[model samples]
Target: MSKPNGQEANHSRQPLLEGRSVSKYFGGLAAVHEVDFAVYPGEIVGLVGPNGSGKTTLFDCLSRVQDIDNGQVLFKGVDITRKKPHQVAHLGLARTFQVIRVYRKMTVLENMLISRQWRGETLWKMLKPSHKDTEQRARELIDFLTINHLTNEKAGNLSGGQRRLLEIGMSLMPNPDLILLDEATSGVNPTLIETIKDRIRALNKDQGISFLMIEHNIQFISDMCSRVYVLNYGQKLAEGTPDEIKANEEVIEAYFGT
Candidate 1:
């Protein structure tokens, strides 16, 4: 593996996830074409592209939501290009979708508890007093997300922005090393967008979690991402710091026609 950039690779100092020359197709349409991407143990990488530029498709391929026609994906230095979604999650990789996903009928705490169940705790213990440790852990996570006040509220009752925050919080239940977020604040009211962004920043700073996000909001990318990659017509058009990306003529043209 080639060395990461000049900076110290941080806590674990490892590439939590990597994609090499990855390509994907859907009935002859190449959504992702020979793209290389990586996320280290403590960093925020943004993926940006226009409507048909293949950002989300590449995300799906990275998260194992779809199989790639060619190329390799590595997690913790192991090839997981062929692993199932559940298998990938077990390896400490998790993803949040473009659309919020929660058990609408369940309370916020219950929704998170359901995800905790898959983290190796026994099903029978979920209700027994023996599950105190498990429930306590769940409470801690809810508190971390600052949603503990809504623990008993039904997930369906959350505002769009709040649901987005909860979805990210739930993804953390398994304590993943890398989190793939597809438009974490899409469809949210502007007032709550900054709150969500702040939480993400805090997690990355405090826990050293790696993030790979696909988003259309230019301000979001400019404000939050340390590095940004722009794709156009299924290929990378530019990759650099947010300032460099903002100044790139190619990226400017891709998002807003000349």
Candidate 2:
């Protein structure tokens, strides 16, 4: 919401999302090894890596989609390492997959409404705060995402990019403190990428929602993020401003052959 206060300050404050010495093992293989990462409020951090470098695995660990072998994940200022996926969502954490996930049977607005999973009420009372609140929020999100025209359209009938926008809208329905977007621009048309980026920026700027995004488009990364983290073979090879990453020899070696 506010222009991230700590960034331009003399010293940086604590991170909103902190992964401390996080490690994940799958059948004796260390996918992520003792990785320590952090993301601050109202900040967008790009996570890049080669295939099988455990980018997705690390994301899974943060969202609790997969169990970690060691280490802890802290959100805000508490340990959420052992929390379940739904538990994490209740804690104000939300995420989107590399592949879009939406309710094909529901309308675009309905798809966004369904993302409000934990409003907590009986079936009859659900419509009071849960349903009505979700509807109001979804309307605002649909307009924000510039997909209000498709509000009543069935989600299954929308294009790939529209569906992706719907998924993002759903993630925002709960007003999360942090959002993990695996690849927001993965299957969308080139024209829609800019729109998606703009919406993300708006949410970060207006709502103070933090973002930890995984993207392959270097140009998009340069345009959208304030800082970036590069992972190679499941290890962090570099982290800094876009210019710093662009000039790093190790990142160059990993992405382009020496």
Candidate 3:
């Protein structure tokens, strides 16, 4: 597959998301220590590191699920270091957890329909039946993700990859400017991994949505991201184009050489 746009072009655009000295602490230890990164508009950036390298902790800080002990996060040029999770979501940011968070008892369509429930609509409206327009939008997204046939299937019954796709669709319901995908390809069969990849490319290329995904699948990151960032021991280990990152000796020793 062809690579994403040149780094020169991305450098000219304001980052859709930026982290300045981002940090998180647990007692005496820092889970994420003063890491800085950026994802420009319409770009697919990869975040990769060994397990327990503070990647998800950084995601938690940026997504505002966890309070940072220090530093700031900005999205679309607006400071969001103190914003609530719902507030960030309202700002066109959405995310998937490393552990999938789909509503197991709900059908695929139901999950998608209610994904936007946290958008500050009236309590009564949320409690009532989903509107026709909302349902139609859900159907269209289902088709886009190529899971239309599973619309009525229970989320619990779906395979690992399908559940991941549902979670992604749930994220897309709000028409986000960026999505933080944590471990999107983990435990997924190879076939569905490709499917997930195609959907992400379609979302980025056709709709102009940006992505910052955490992945252990190096090949997936190599194929999808124009730029990649590496974290190790709660700090920025490396940042560059995929080829440059692959050639970094420090990154290889800390991450890939294991």
Candidate ranking under TM-score, highest first, comes to 3, 2, 1
Superposed on all Cα atoms, the candidates' RMSDs to the truth, in angstroms, are 3.8, 2.9, 2.1
Candidate 3, poorest ten consecutive residues by summed lDDT: 1-10
Query: lDDT by residue for model 1 over 209-239, one digit each (tens)?
Result: 7788899887888777778889998998899
Candidate 3, residue 108: how far the Cα is off, in Å: 0.5
Better of 2 and 3 by TM-score: 3
- The C-alpha lDDT values of all candidates are 0.82, 0.82, 0.89
Each prediction's TM-score versus the true structure = 0.89, 0.91, 0.94
Look at candidate 2 and tell me the lDDT of residue 250: 91
lDDT by residue (1-258, candidate 2, tens digit) is: 323222221127777889988998888777888888888776888898787778889999988889988989999888899988878887888888887889898899877766776333234654575577667878988998999999999999988888888888888876789989988888899888979988887777677778888999888888877788888877788898777899999999999869
Give per-candidate clash totals. 0, 1, 0
Leading candidate by lDDT: 3
